[model samples]
Target chain A: MRFTSLSGLALGLALSSTAAFAGEIVLNSDQSDPAPKKAMEELIANFQAANPGITVKWNNFDHEGYKSAINNFLKANPPDVAAWYAGNRMAPQVKAGLFEDVTDVWEKNGLNDQLKSAAPSMTIDGKKWGVPYTYYQWGIYYRPDVFKANGVNVPKNWAELVAACAKLKAAGIAPFAIGSSQKWPTGGWFDYMDLRVNGYQFHMDLTGGKVAWTDPKVKAVFDKWAELVKPGYYIENAAALDWQDAIPQFASGKAAMYLMGNFAVAPMMKAGLKEDQLDFMQFPEITAGIPMAEDAPTDTFHIPSGAKNKDDAKKFLAFVASADAQTKLNATLGQLPVNSGSAKPDDKFLKAGFAMLSSAAGLAQFFDRDAPAEMASAGMDGFQEFMVHPDHQDAILARLEAVRAKAYK
Target chain B: MSAIAAQPDAPLAASWWKRNQLQLAPWLFLAPGIFAFAVYVMIPIVQSVSLSFYEWDGLTPDAKWVGFGNYTELWTDPDFWTSLRNNVAWLVMYLLAVPAGLAVALFLNQNVTGIRVYKSLFFFPFVISQVVVGLMFRWFYAPNFGLLSGVIKTLTGSNIAILADDRYATYGIIAAGLWPQIAYCMILYLTGLNNINSEQVEAARMDGARGWKLLWNIILPQLAPATFIAVVVTVIGALRSFDLVSIMTKGGPYGSTRVLSYYMYEKALSEYGFRMGYGAAIAVVLFLIMMVFITYFILQMLRQERDA
Candidate 1:
C-alpha cells in the first residue's frame, strides 16, 4: 500500500499542470464578442492586480459552441472558474454535482445584500451555486420614429398594444420583428407573454414542470400571443431569419418594434439607427393587478467541482461580485450590474432598463434560462409552431404537455 | 532437418518465423487498418449500442440502465416519425442525381473548343466544401433578398421564404445537397466513359447502331460499374444528410427538416441535447436502415465477383 501510494503521488505530481499550481487559477468563459471579450480581459487584469502573486489564465470560447462544450470540459479538463448562466439553466450541472457550491462565498461577501436582485436565480435548494455579476433587461426595444410616422402611441396595456399592432400593420409596417431561426428569440417572446399574462409564479411553475402546459392559464398566455401573431402583426418568414437579421428590418423601418434584450441596442446602432430613433419600453400589462415581473437574464461565474485551486477561485468570485468591480465591468459590457451598490451606466437604454427593472415587482430569467433544457427546447419549438399556425394551438400545446410529462422524469 | 534443429547455433526464433511467415505476413500488413477500423468505428458502434440501453447525460459518472425504454420512446415520438419521413424524401429525391449526372457527363463528353474550361466549371460545386455549398444555397433561397426569391417575386408576385416554409425547407436543402452530389456522380461516369472500348463502339456504329439505340445497347452496359458506385455513394450521402440541414436551417422552423442523423445530434450532442440514450436509439434506427442497403450492395459485389 505504501509503494502504491508513493507511485500515485509521483504520478499526481507529474500530471499536475501549471494552472493547478499554488497562486494560479484557470478561467473558462465564452466572452468571445468584442465588448464582452474586452470586459473579461479587464476583469482578469484587475483580479490579478488586486491579488498580487496570483495569476489568471482565461480560455475564451465563442458563445454558441461553449454551451455544448462546457459539458465535456467541466468533467474532463475542468478549469478553476467557469462562466455560465444563472437560474434553471445551471440546475443540471448543480444537480449532477459538477458545480461547486459558492454559498460560503455569498455569505462571506454579504452578496445576499449587495446582489439581492439576482439572489433567487442564483439559489437552488436554499444554496447559491454561482455568483451573477451582470444581467440585461428583456423588453420592447423599438423605433419610436416609426411609431410616430404611423401616428401610433406607446402601448401600456393588452388592448392598446393590439391596437398599436393593427395601426402599424395598416401603415405597411410589421408590428414586431422577430428572427427566430435560433428559437431562443421566440423564448423571449414566450417569457414576456407568460410573465405579463399569468404573473411570475405561474410562469416559473409552468417552466419548472409543476404546471401542465394544457392548463387554462397557459392557454391564456398563448391566447394573448395569438392576438399579435394571428393579425399579421409580426414580420413574415421570421423562422428563417436569425435575431441579428431581424435588426435590419427594424433599423430600416420595415418593422417598428423588436421584443429583445438590451444587448440588441448596440447592433441597432450599428445598423445605423440613431439614439433618438432607438427606444426601450416595458412589455405592456396583460392581466390587471398582476405585479409586472420582468425578465432580467443574469450571467454568472462558478467554480467547477474538479477545480484544484478552490481558494483562488473563491477569491475571484468574491472580486467579481463586488460593487466596484461590477460597475467597471457593466460599464464596458453596456449592461446592468447585479450588485445594488454598483453605479448604473448612463447609456440611454441601460438607464431606462435599470429604472424599469428596479421598480418591477419581481424578475424571472428569460425562458431558455428559466426552464430545464429539455423543456425549454421543446417549449420554444412549440411557441414557434403556434406563431406560424395559430389554428394548431391545441396540437402544439398538447405536444408540449407530452414533452413536459416525459422531460421532468 | 532434425540434425539442423539439433545444432546448437540454429536459432529457435528464425525457424519459427520461417514456418509461419507466409500466413502471418498478410495479417501484419492488415494490422494497422484493422486496428484503426476497430478503434474509430467498431468500438463506438458497440458503445453506442450499449449506451442505448442506459440513460446518460454524456457528463454524469453514472448512467441509469433503462433497457428498451429509449427505443420505445422513439417509437411513439412524433419528431422521430417526421425525421424518418424526411429521410425517405431525401433518399428518393437524392437518387435523381445519378441520371442528372449521366446527362451532364454525356453532354460534356465531346471534342470541342474550350471543353476543359466548361468541364472544370461544371465540376466546380464538388470542388468546394459542403459548408460553402450550404451557405451559398442558404443565401440563394433567403426570403426577401435572395436571388431565387427575387425572381419568384417578379414572376408570381408573392414573397416566399423557402427555408422557413415546412413544405419547401426539406426540398430546398435536398436541392443544395444535390448540386455537389451530381458533380461527384458525373466525375465517376466521365471516368467510365473514357475506359469504354472505342473499337466496339465503331463496330456498332458500322452496323447502323446510332444515337439512343447505339448508346443504350453499347454504352450503358459498359458503364454499369460506375452506375453501381454512384448509386452506393448517393444512397450513403442521402442517409447521412446532416451538414446542409445543419448549416441552412439546423432542422428548424419547428424541426420540419430534421433527418435521423440531425435529430440524433439534437437529442445527443447539441446545445440543448443531453439524452445520450435517446440519441443512441435514433442512431440504431438509422444504422439498421443503412444496413439494409449496405447488405444489398455487398451481396451484389459478391455475386459480380462470382460471375468474374
Candidate 2:
C-alpha cells in the first residue's frame, strides 16, 4: 500500500513538471560539484526573485555523463536553457540547428561588451550561440621554493625555460609533472605550446584544420616541446597516471612545475602546499616577438533550438550574462568570471590569473574546445605518443596529418 | 432444433481447444519471450546493418545513404587494423587460461583436508565482479608504488609502468582477465570431475596405470564434455572482452591496447564519436567476426547432439 502511494506521488510530480505552464522555464546544466551546485541554486533563486512571475525548473547532471546527455536531450527533449562549452564544441550543435541563436539577446542586453573576452569563441558567422558565464586561465603552476633552491629564475622565453629545466634536472628533480592518462591535461600543455610557438592565429587555424599538421610550423612547435621531453624533464611514467595522481609528485617535491588550469590551484593547496611555496607564471614564450596568448576555456549557457519557452530562456540567458550574477556565481565557483565588468576575484591565484588574462593579446578556448571532438581526440593521443618518444616526431605528425584530412570533412 | 447447432460436429468444434491444448498452450507461453527477442536483439541487429550504409551524426534526422562508404574507409583505417590485431592476440593468449585452469583443477581434485575451504578460496576471483578485478590488477601493475613495479624497482633500480607502454599494456590487461577466467574454468572442471564414472577410474587404478597414463587414457576422455564447455565459454568471453579493456586502459596509450569491441565503442559511442554510420560499420564487422566462431561452435554442438 505504501509503495503504490509513494510511486503515485512520484508519478504525479513528474507529470506536473513535464506539463509546465507559460511562466516556467526548464533549465538543464552540469553543476554537480558541491560549490557549483550551491551557486546554481542561489543563482536560480535570485533569478526567480528578480522576475517574480517566471519560475525556473533546473535539471543538473554529473560532469562526464552531462557531455553525452546534452547531445541526446538537445535533439529529443530540449530544455529551455542548456549548459555547454564555447568554440568548436558548440559548432556541431549550431550547425545541426540544435542550439538557438541568442545574438539579439546579446545586442539588446549589451552582453557583447561585458562578455568581450569570450565573444570570439561564442560567435560563428557573426551570430552568438551561447552566453558564457565563467572560465579559468591555464598556465604554468610551479613550486617557487624549488625554483629558488635550484637557482633557477622563472622562465620568460623558450631558451630560458629550457635552461631552467636543465638546472632542475641536474638538481635531481623532474622539471615538469604531467599525467597523460585522461589526455585533457596534455591538451592544456599542447595549447600553450602551440600558442606560444606559432602564435594564436596559426594555432587556431591548425586546430580548425586550415593549416596542415605536416606544415613546418607545426613541426617547429613539436621541436620546441622536444627540448623538455628529450631531456627526461617530465616525471617518469606520466602516461599511466591521471592528472590528480601526478599532483602528489609536485606536492612531494618529486617534480617542480605543472602546466594546468587555475582549477588545479585548490587541489594543489589541498595536497599540502603553502601559498608562498606555490606560485603561478604565464606560460613562457616560444617564438620571438609573438604576442602572448593565454588559454581560457569558457563554460556557457545556450537556449536549445527545440525549446518550448524561447522567451523565458532568453531572459534567463540575459540574467546569467549580467555582471552581478557572474560575480557572485564565479566567487562560488572559485574561478574567473567571463564578464569583464564583474569585480576581481578575492583568491590570490585567481587574481594572478585575472591579471595575466587582462593583458593577453588574445584568449583561446583550449585545444579540446577549439578543435572538433574527433580531431581533439586524435590530436591528444598523438601528443601523448610524441611526449613519450620525441624521436617519433615525423611519424606522429604524419599520422595526425592523415587524421586531420578526414576529420575536417 | 436451432439448425442443430449448424452442424452435426458442433459439440466437437466447441471442444477444439482440448484437442490442441498441448501445442497451442506452449506457443501462448512463448509469445512474450519471442516478442522481446524480436524487439531487442534480432531487430536491432538488422537495423544496425542497414544503418551502416548511411552517414549520420547521431544528432540530426538527416542520414545520407552512402553504400560501402564506411566499409571502404575502415579498410584504410589504421586504428581498425590495430584493434583487429589486438583482438587476435587476445584470443590466442586467453586460450592459455584453459590449460592453466585444468592444471589447477587437477591438482585440487585429490582428497585432502579442509578441501572445501581451499576450493572456495580458489573460486573467490570468479565471484568478484569484473570491474573490481580490473581495478585491482590496474593498481597491481601501476608505476612508482604498485606491487610489480615496486618489486622491479627494488631489484633493478628501474620502474616500468606496464599499462603505460603500448607493447605491454594489452598483455597486462590479458593477465588480469585470466585471473578470473582461470578460476571459472577450474570450477567447470571441478564439477566435471564430480560426475566422472568412478568404476572406470577404479579399474584403471587397479591395473597399475597410476600416473599420467591413467589420467590421459581414462580421466581425460570422461572430461571431454567439460573441456568442450570450457572452450566455448572462453571463446565467447574472449570476443566479449570489452569490460576489462574499458576498465583497465580505456584503449589508451594512443589506442594501442584497443580490441574490436573497445574500438567499436570508441568509433561509435565515445565523446568524439557521434558518427553513427561509421560506428555501425565497426559493429557490423565485429558481429561478422563473431559469426565465424559462433557458426563453428553451433555446428559442433549440432553434431554432438545428433551423435547423442
Q: Assess each prediction's global lDDT (C-alpha) against the native.
A: 0.92, 0.90
Residue-by-residue lDDT tens digits, candidate 2, B1-308? 76886776786887799788988999999999999999999999999999999988887779999999999999998889999999888899999878888888998998899999999899999999999999999899999778999998999989889999998999999999999999999998999999989999999999898789988999889999999889988888888899999898889898899998888787777777778898899889989988999999899999999999
Docking class of predicted structure 2: medium
lDDT of 1 at B54: 94
Per-model DockQ: 0.70, 0.63
Docking class of 1: medium
Per-residue lDDT of model 1, residues A248-273, tens digit only: 99999999999999888877889999
Model 1 CA lDDT for position A19: 38
lDDT of 1 by residue, B60-92 (tens): 778999999999999889999999999999999
- Give each model a TM-score: 0.95, 0.92
The parts of candidate 1 lying over 4 Å away from their true place are A1-24, B1-5, B8-14
Question: DockQ of candidate 2?
Answer: 0.63
Top TM-score prediction, candidate number: 1
